[model samples]
Target: MRLWLLLLLLFACPAYASEPAVDTLPPELVRLRDEGRLTVRALWAWKLVPAATATAAMELRAMGLDLIGADRAQLAAWVREAEEGTAAFSPAQREVLSGLLAMMDSGDAAASADMLPADAPAAAALPVPGVVDAVPAAPDTVDTAPPAPDVADAAPPLPDVAEAAPSVPGAASGPAMYRCGAARTGVSDASGPAGPPVELWKLKVGDGPCTPPVVLDGLACFGSVDGHLYAVDVATGALKWKFFAEDWVDQPPAMAGGTVFFGNVVGDRSGDRHFFALDAATGSEKWRFKSLYYGVNSSPAMVDGAICFGAGKHVYSADPQTGDAKWSLETSDTVGTPAVSDGTAFFAHANRLTAVELGADAEKWTFRAGANITTCPAVSDGLVVFGSDDFNIHAVDVQTGVEKWKFGTGLIHHPAAVHDGVVYAVSADNLHALDAATGTEKWKVNMQRAGLKAPVIDGDALILAAGNFLVSLDRASGQERWRFEAGGEITSPALAGGVAYFWSEDGHLYAVR
Candidate 1:
């Protein structure tokens, strides 16, 4: 045979005896190889070992993905990142490793091997502040001192350590949870400061938007888009401690019994499923709960000794300490953040609003709306109030699931705040105060916009966090009392001791008296 014919003849020698036929190979892998998903070098090496029988299933146990659907995705990600390692593998992991070793030891010049799951989140907390008596200088411990202002004349000096204030006063004895109290009512019993309030202090957290501040134990706590949950000194605007979550932290941290509960909402499936519990004072993790599908967008609502939240397609109640599931109610569609009132969790799933018992895991009732529900169900009195995509605010009887009233609005995006028999709903550019029982419009005021966030009832004023500005309207009459414009995108105010703490996208946490 000629040189080319001799090589072609050698390549054509297929089945020796014990090896599986080429037709018996996995069609999916063959399809992937044919589509050029695998690299040229990998395909060449795979061809070198014609009898290699390694699979990708047992090798990716650490990735925490749906293994049945993740072989291609995980392998692609690993190869794209140029994965390399010689670390010890678990027994099952070694099963594939042994296969690769046997091929490599067969004197083959190149043998292809899939990568392991190295991107999974470690069980231990990464890095945080105040976990011990002394923490060496690290990313979590930051010294945030502002520079002098730029001005033509003599500028005001920034907050100096020499003139530093005393310790941040503790927020009474009550540990603050998300959405005002455990009920998630968005109603604060205490009043914000009267008149044009003065700026007390501002501290830049991370280079991203922050979750609404949750005040507890002398620390003003919040999560940042920069993947950290920060606890700052309320009095001095100094960084106390921060917990690095390694993922976007959008939801507010709920605190109780010296533990902070928050969620990590990762858009990518790589790290999308953990509800974390960190120590309130130390920033150390207590426990983390996992879920399927998308990361946790719903904030945890602590109620009746169990932490309740709707994650993915299930309504889950976990123990506050161990992160163990107390009860889980599987739903047909996605679920929203739940508000607990009288042992019942009210959440919106697609076009229906459902109520499930927190303790018994029994579903009380489900109320179907005309359109997709856009907001969390706010429970007040005996009614559950929510907004639908059809531009109507529906108030359903909490016990019977019967629709009490359906009031039309221009464009209702956020849930209505119910306080003192009043349902405060915000439309595109209008704020309406209606009777909670009758759904009768009592007052309506037009503004530039109602803002993206839900309305917060602070004493007699209705705070419309109009994106970057704070509009305080008289809750009774819908008259504007004060409108404070922030430097960047601001969130709804979290009131602590007559002070309003606004988390701004400008990376500053503003404390206004």
Candidate 2:
């Protein structure tokens, strides 16, 4: 009887937010596909471009194009070679070729930032190096010479950067942690700003990439590498309060019922980890739990009365009120944050993505990938989506564990976001929008070395963190609407109440309107 009920629950449908249909490509872009081959060679030049440009000449050569002198004669010579009819170029093809040649002659750098490489470069994109570059450095070595400093007692004065946005009326209460609620689908409940975004203010926090802030009740909360979880006034960019975790706090805190749940890594290798429940009103510790693990970087997901998070190779569900262990499930390797839907909790580790029946202590099913899975699973519309070091974005059945479909990408080190029926995925330098049902490519654009965060859906724009820029693109056509450059690599960003909040690796928190 229980099995039958479980099966019914797995296949049940849930309410989904309304989203528009994917946009068709521009006429010029449509012409690039001729008989299954992309004749726009420059569009695929990304395969040959180096990860970072060193010299203009090297960049051109790396993209499989010649670096010619900036002269009309030189450009004409190259044009003539292509115009002489090698592949029976169509008018559209010829125009694209001319554009490529012109860009090459003029040393256009944006060309290399877009597109995938074919031939030799495509093969280079497939290798899984022994050391995965997207994985951030673990807090391995601890300075044993002196003890760590204490938590901040008084609110630090906000540093001068940009003017803060005017205080807006926020929720009567606080914002729920993670993705607004326990679902963790990466969808923001707060409406995004309309049209091009503008920077409102920036405040320097402790060093290290700041975890995506959890906004609620006019306060934005996040932890920093300098061992502090900070609460900042969202409207004025003022520091509200800070709690020091004696160790590094890389994961965002989960808030529920006016309490915050978070964890920190231990410096020593003894593998002693700690989880704490703090009063949302006061930064005072409410309860603390110690686990025999090295760290807990996974953001906690609150379901039922328990808060679930992953530490090392285990997933622990603890009572949100008392921080007592409810149960623990061991995975093959270290686990990412778990996303809950229906009665299942989804997590990824090593090369396997597994689903556990919450509170039942039973396995639902597991799907294996070709390589390590680093990002958390985003669940919506009866499907789960995640990216892998295997250079593929996978979508799978939420119930039967069937392989629905997969899309090949360069290296998907971040999570994929799904809304309405579209999946937004990032690889190396490209952002792809795929049909959520069949994994068909709807449209794609280059993001110039994209960062490791799931794209946030705001009104009509899909916000992305790309290297040092916070970029907003048209959800339908992948067109750039606006960009805000930062001092360092930007991590994940959060959107709420017409404002987008994010942090950079340079230890600064920014609010853009």
Candidate 3:
């Protein structure tokens, strides 16, 4: 993205609240697309061009260069070239930019505080040019650090600087712990946000993507690519504490008895990766199990006092409090986040859904799919359901790991939601409701470009996001109820105390109510 467009987007509202349908693209945009100049980034910026120019003008004005109407018109031309896009700007707009460039050539520039903030804590549409470039590609080695300083959970608005850097309810009164973490029950009873949510607060932790947060013990904790697990006050969004992982902490943490357990990704480094248990209140290290070969992105499932998660080529069951290994089962690849039920850990990887008796580390059975499984299995009603790249939804018997039923559909990515014996599978173009006992379709609604994260069941509504709209659908009828427009494409949502918590690539963890 061009530097100007980035600044403009940061200042202006989204171009469109919902994904633009094919019929809606303006003529100029369609023409650019035909000319091969309208890239995804260019299209997005063009959509916002109507509102983007004002911000750039304000910043330029502060630098003592007055921008006229012609200059502003030429701005679009400058934007495309800034990113090396082929789109042409109006001649009227181009002339203005030429003059502005000439003036800038004389070093007549002023540092615009609004363009980048002082903290350098939040990220932009993309990583800032030098921000990630500044960090060493790989750290030397792993270091175990205890309780770190508290970050203000409720900090100021997303800092100007571009750089910084879901879970099972059945298992109770918390948001989804990881992406489809509540797969076993596939339901949450918490009533998320009563109305169109207003941004209550945001915490600028790092200049990278954050994992879906696990809200536990009055604190919202999640890992970040910055190699830290951050715990913030749920009510105030104040950073209570943070623990450094010395590598990317890419998954959500599992919290039990005031201790938060989570995993990280071992990048291009020789040092072994570590899965850690940290003090929830103070961010102190309790214990950590070091990985032998792979880094862990699978969020651990806590059941029967065992933390079961897949890392490297194995799924291990360890004591959550002590990080002592009880059992480890070798797997074919890095496994999906495990769902727990009846003392069994259910997860997917390499086109197979496997069940293992926890504690004993005994294999129960494995159900192989026709294609690679794209998500964790949603277990319910004695059946475990999941989607695959085979363009099918498969439900297997929990006891036998045998295919109970399969429903064909477009490629599925997000984990399905099962509530009241019904599997709610949100696929690329359809939100399907199927009978959990059989593969019978109960109801189906067109989602049309749904998000990749699993939907959250808030009371009787399925909260889903497509494009920039966070939509609520009646769970039973599959009828749309409401749509909340966010600043960016919404990801996963977690609810607690009527507040819906979700994050987007826009660089902030949003708590809305």
Candidate topping lDDT = 2
lDDT (Cα, tens digit) per residue for candidate 1, span 378-401: 888998888876678999998998
The alpha-carbon lDDT assigned to residue 119 of candidate 3 equals: 36
What is every candidate's alpha-carbon RMSD to the true fold?
Answer: 14.9, 22.4, 15.7
- Clash list (residue pairs), candidate 1: none
- Alpha-carbon lDDT, every model: 0.63, 0.64, 0.61
What tens-digit string does per-residue lDDT give for candidate 2 at 430-482?
A: 88999999999999887656453568887677887888888888888999988
Which sections of candidate 3 miss by over 4 Å?
1-176, 179-183, 268-271, 450-452
- Which candidate leads the pack in TM-score? 1
Candidate 2 achieves a global lDDT of 0.64
Reference-based lDDT, residue 207, model 2: 41
Off by over 4 Å in 2: 1-175, 266-272, 450-452
Over all chains combined, what TM-score does candidate 2 have?
Answer: 0.66
Ranking by lDDT: 2, 1, 3
Rank candidates, TM-score, best first: 1, 3, 2
lDDT of model 3, residue 201: 75
How many residue pairs clash in model 3? Answer: 23
